[model samples]
Target: MSVWDSIVGQQAVVGQLQAIVSGDPKALAQSWLICGPPGSGRSNVARAFAAALESPDRGLSDEPTNITRQVLSGTHPDVTTLATNKVTIGIDDVRQLILTSEQMPSTAPWRIIIIEDVDRMLERTTNVLLKEIEEPSPHTIWLLCAPSAQDVLPTIRSRTRIVNLAVPSTKAVADYLMASVNPALPAERQFDRHVAVRAARLAEGHIGIAKLYASDTQVMSDRDELIVGLLGLRKASDAVLLADDLIDTAKSQAEADVNRQTAAAEADFRRINGLGEQDRIPPKLRGAYNAIAKKDEIKRRATRRSRDVLDRALNSAASIYRDIAVLQNNAEDAVGLINMENRTAIAELSARLSRQEVVDRLEAITVARKRLLGNGNPMLVFEALFCALIPGRL
Candidate 1:
């Protein structure tokens, strides 16, 4: 399939990118910024654009050529990608990428450097990158991806041509999920239309989360448990217990994810160094392994990842209140509901709580997210949030 086919619900942006690749050489910019919300396929679009730029026919062919495949797999020598798992991209990483950007393409028409999570860079690090973007090499191209253009410095934003991507419609997401199901799997294991639609709506236009919800029954069950638990909250004691549960769950999930990534990194390092799984590392190679797998950085990343997990939960919690507000205001048709499967519970909550109460709960969720971002204590933050969510407490 064409590389562009994997890009979901971004026809307009894809068209713009294709035009740049096929249009006059003078029209091409050295730097480009792709901005979108989480799970909106920002990095996918960047990779596709990189592939198209490097393709012999500029991705005009129906089938992706060898060069396109290499770029997408991140094996292309001319394409350098910086995707950080940590909360921030370090200055040293960006400096190294800058040095790479100066070299011309080995074989492809243009060398591409893709930076995912450009928004994670600090001001000082962004300044270091700004100079390179300002004076990019003729054969080099920089593609930066972020949740939004405002996340980056104004200087970097102005220097790059910006491509803004919107969230795909719920139906689009559902259809994509349904089509993505492997026919080779048993019917029971495959996602049906109903499951696809439900997951898509629950994800609220987040393709990645929708896929997770569709494929993993556990994810959907966990979300249901969380929403049901929140709606069932009736007292301060219930709030405290649930808050603790939330913290524990987020920490456990984050640690599991971090552990998996660390294990894979170590395995890859060992494989590259020609060491067996059971082989002892040489003293020289131990330092190299330690450099790549820093214990301190892993701990920091786990903390941040846990905060991210909590933030997603906060978003889901807010969505329930949003649904309740919609029902209370009789704006169901206009605003629609995210948690439609919980209509009965939502209706009960709507009747029990005033519109103002629902609004306050939503505001509290917003505040909790901000506090989490500001490095507030998660346990205290969630405790205060859950307490604020008590019905009629506001």
Candidate 2:
């Protein structure tokens, strides 16, 4: 299929990129910024745009060429991508990308650089990148992805053409989920239409999240448990216990993710060094391996992952309260509810608590999220949130 096929509910964006790819090469800007909400496929759009630019027929053909395939897989020689899991992108990383940007394209018509989460870079690092963007090489093209233009420095945003992508409609996302084959699943397996529709609704227009909710039964169960637990809370002790449980779960998930990533990195390092799975590293190579397995970076990544897990839980919690508020205001049918499966529980909670109490709990969730992001103690933050969520605690 065509490279753009993978992108869902973005026909206008595809059309814009297609026009640019088909237009005069000399008139194209050297840098572009792609802005969208989380799971809205900002990174996917960047890669698709890069593929189109490098495609033999300029992405007009029905099927992707080999160049398009390579670009999509991120194995193309002319494409450089930086997609980090860390809390921030360091200055050194930007410097390295700058060096890569100076080189001429080895094979393709343009040397493309795609940086996902550009907002993660601090001002100093962004300044380091600004010079290159301000005066990029003639054949170099930069594609930056962020949640919004406001996330990046004005100097950086001003130098590039901005493309904004909106959240897809619920029906659109549900249809895509039903039609798309998840590579992680068995070839013979497909998403049930009912499940896809529910996932799309729960995800609130986030395609990545909708896929997760559809494919992973555990995620859906955990969300259900959290909402149920919140509704069942009747005392401060219960709130404290749930907070501890949440923290422990977040930590366990983060640790597992870090261990997996470390194992994969080690395996890749061994393969690159011509060593087998059971092979021992030579003395000289041991230091290099140690450097690759820096403890600080691993710790930071784990912390970030833990925080991410908790943040998602908080978002889910907020959605539950939002649904309750909708029911309280008698707008359930008009605006619809995110967690339709939990409508019974939400409706009961709506009846138990005052409208003002629901508002207080929602505000508490917003504060908890902010404090969590600000490096506040997660346990305390969660405890406060849970306590506020207790019915009539306000």
lDDT of 2 by residue, 311-337 (tens): 879988989888988998889889899
RMSD of each: 3.6, 3.5
lDDT (0 to 1) per candidate:
0.88, 0.88
Clashing pairs in 1: none
How do the predictions measure up, each by TM-score?
Answer: 0.85, 0.85
Q: In model 1, where is the ten-residue run with the lowest total lDDT?
A: 180-189
Instruction: Give the per-residue lDDT digits (tens) of candidate 1, residues 1-394.
Output: 8878878888899998888888888778989999999999999999999999899878778888999999999999999999986668999999999999989899988889999999999999999999889989888999999999999899999999999999988888888887765354467767788888998888888888888788767667878888988989999999999889888878877787788788989999999989999999999888878876688988887887787678779979989988887888789999699998789988998989877777788888889888887778889999999999988689
Local error of candidate 2 at residue 372 (angstroms)? 2.8
Candidate 2, lDDT over the whole model: 0.88
Best candidate, TM-score? 1
